[model samples]
Target: MDAPSGIISAIVTGLVIGVLGRLVVPGRQAIGCLMTILVGLIGAAGGLAIANAIDAAWLLTLLLQIGVAAVLVLITASATGRNQ
Candidate 1:
């Protein structure tokens, strides 16, 4: 894909991954949508980096991204004391 489309795809994928991460966690978090998106974006990039370094499969990479997102969400929620 072209640069713009690639970026767009990343954003979309990041959003989905972020939502999936949130869903995996139990209880309601007080974080906003924007914060969630940011977490997803960071998770996606970080997970992808590690996955790529290890030559992980596409599915594994996606799962890793979601996992990372979940961890990030948990960290943020705890740090902000949004949900205890």
Candidate 2:
């Protein structure tokens, strides 16, 4: 994919993954949309790395991505000291 399309796809994926991660986590998070998107981007990248290493299936890859995002959300919330 081209650079522009890749960036756009990443943003859209990040938004979906971030929201899904937030929904998976319990209670409220103190992070904002940008932070969530960042977390999602990182999580997606990490998950993809791990999945590639393990040769995981698509479903498992998605689950790993979501799981990573959830952990990131928790960590971010704790770091911000506003997880309720």
Candidate 3:
């Protein structure tokens, strides 16, 4: 993908990853849509950075991404005082 396409792909992937992360966390989180997207984007970016450092396989990389996203969601929820 080119630059714009790559960015769009990242946003889309981030949205999905963020939603999946929220789902993984078993509780009602008070985060909004935009916040969710932002969290997901950050999580995905963080996860990819770590994955690059580790040079893991695709499956493990994916799991790590999702796991990282979940952690971010949890943190966001806690920070927002919505995780209870």
Q: Give the local distance difference test score of model 3.
A: 0.87
Residue pairs of candidate 2 with colliding backbone atoms: none
RMSD of each: 1.5, 0.7, 1.4
On residues 13-48, what C-alpha lDDT tens digit does candidate 2 reach at each position?
998888888999999998999999999999899888
* TM-score per candidate: 0.88, 0.96, 0.88
Model 2 scores worst on lDDT over the 10 consecutive residues at 14-23
Candidates 2 and 3 compared: the better one by TM-score is: 2
lDDT of each: 0.89, 0.93, 0.87
Best-fitting candidate, scored by TM-score:
2
Tens-digit lDDT track for model 3 on 1-84?
A: 689999899789989989988999998898989988888898888888888899988887777788899999999999989776
| Candidates sorted by lDDT, best first | 2, 1, 3
Candidate 1 lDDT by residue in tens digits, 6-82: 98897888788788889888888888888888889999998899899999999999899999999998998999998
* Candidate 2 lDDT score at position 16: 88
Candidate 3 local lDDT, residue 34: 90
lDDT score at residue 29, model 2, on the 0-100 scale: 97
Pairs of colliding residues, candidate 1: none
